[model samples]
Target: MKVLHIIPSVAKVRGGPSKAVIEMVKALRSQNVDAEIVTTNDNGKDLLDVPLDILTDRLEEYGNVPIRFFSRFSPNLNAVREFAYSGALTAWLWQHITDYDIIHVHAIFSYASTIAMAIARIKNVPYINRPLGQLCEWSLQQSKLRKQIYLNIIERSNLLHSQSLHFTAEQEREEFHQLGLNIPNFVLPHGVHIPEPIPDAQDKLRQILQIPHQIPIILFMSRIHPKKGLEYLIPALSKFQDSNFAFVIAGNGESDYMNQIQDLLEKHRISDRTHLVGFVNGETKNLYLQGADLFVLTSHSENFGIAVIESLAAGTPVLITNGVAISPMVKEQDLGYVAQLDSEAIASTIQEFFEHPQVAKQKGDRAQQYIAEHYSWAKIAHSLINIYAKYAKYTKL
Candidate 1:
């Protein structure tokens, strides 16, 4: 089967959706499915270097998967932040819509996804729409009037016409039902690449960050955005200001929001204990995972916390809020604590881990085992292929 994925950008800084697309395509190819991506050259900023070559309206190969990048035009409007308007990409999709058996549009309220769905519909090609947590209540409430207008004008139709709506977790699938779209839903969790015999150099993160060996590290690795619930996380960490643990905040965000985070740390007098390590990836990310005693994500709403699974794969216990879709699995597998989205609850959970170090270690071991057995890319690929076969006219899988 040939599958074409349309996304806004495949830039690493775009976070989970970009990473998920790359991994999914790679996995699909391994299962004998022909997978490719079409995206715009909007890497969030000119300074952010994406791995893809910036040749306009041309296809480039990232391993076995072909990626076509188009030059994007940005409208000077605050309301439409990060929306890449690419007429070239839209025209290209219209021209080649029927070349693939299936079109998978990732994320919503984007030019690529909306146009791809329209083209796919005109060509009578089946398409899968992954909202990537956009349909959740918390996300939809943001820029409310603007989104409602967009939804009525474009997104609602785009969603209703799709062959299937893909959700990364049961929570997302359930939340999507509230939209009353009457579309078929496919529920599958995001897959992570588990490192075998997990990297053992523990001191790399500490040495690089100038953190001491004895200090316990509580890692939070994701985009530094308001929806991540870092405002609550900062106050929670402040509760342990006198403790020996170091709270590390990684990933990049807008200057104003990041400043707000810094101000919160200072106000609570936890500045000395908290470290903002900026953005980290590759070996540095792995080291942060391995070197830490615990990882936490207090997101307001997450379809699937990829970092939570990454932490588990690294054998580090996690503490996540109920807002995170994967929190149920974390609780069921005994990987870590799942608490209410309250600063008191988060602080208390972290305290429990600190008080019982041996218990934390056991939970971390279970985390690693659970992720390896259930979240492997090969396993995820098979499930997705089955979903595609159910909807696509082509029988080959």
Candidate 2:
């Protein structure tokens, strides 16, 4: 089967959606499915020197999957940040929409998604819409006016017309149902790539960051966005000022948001205890995960916390709030601690882990085993192929 994936960008800095697309495509190809991607060059404000190296409009190989990148008409638009507005990309989709058996568009309210879905409909091609946590209650509340306008203007129709709405978790599917949209839903959790253990990872991380060997590290490794509930985490962690723990926040965000985080650190008087290591990727990212005593993600609403799984894969126990869709799994499997969204609850959980170091280590070991057994990309890809086959056969009928 031939599948075409349309996304805004695959730049590493774009976070989970980009990573999801790349990993999913690679996995699909390994299952003997012909998978390809078409995206725009949307590097956002904080561009990470990613090698685009585009020589033509034709497809180029990014790893094993083929991909095409189009240049945006207006690169900068304060009103619509991180959006890819490319006439060339839309034209290409129009010309080739019928070539694929399935069109999987990741993320909603973007030019890529809207145009791809519109063209796919005209060509009578079945398309699946992956909102990537956009439909959650917390997400809907942000930029309410703009989202409402977009919903009425384009997104509502784009959503209704799709063959299926893909959700990474049941929590996300339920949230989408709350929107009153009558659409077929498919729930498939995103997979993770479990890395081999690095023997010197902890030592390397400590040396690079200038952190002492004895200090316990609580790591937060995601985009520094308000939705991450860092405002709550900072204050909760402030209660640990007297503790021998170091809070390392290893991601970048808007300048204003970064300033807000810095302000929170100062206000809590934990500036000396907290370290902002900026955006980390590649080996540095793995080292941080391997080196950390514990990993924490206090997102207000996450469809699937990829970092949570990554932490587990790194053999580090996680501490996450109920807002994370995977929190139930963490709690049920004893992979980590699950707390209420309250700062007090989060703070108390951290204290529990600190008090019981041996329990934390056991949990971390369990987490690694669970992730390896259950969250393989190959298994996830096979399941997705079955779903596509079912839908594709129905479309033919």
What's the lDDT for all of these models? 0.84, 0.85
- Tell me the tens digit of each residue's lDDT in model 1 across 150-252: 9999889888988899999998888888888899898888899886443444576678768788788889999888889988888888887668888898898
Question: Which residue pairs overlap in candidate 1's backbone?
Answer: none
Residues 85-195 of candidate 2: C-alpha lDDT, one tens digit per residue: 788888888888888888899998788888898888888888998998999999989889988899889888888988889999888888888889999888999899998
Output the worst ten-in-a-row residue range by lDDT, candidate 2. 53-62
Best by TM-score: 1
- Candidate 2: C-alpha RMSD to true structure equals 2.7
lDDT of 1 at 236: 84
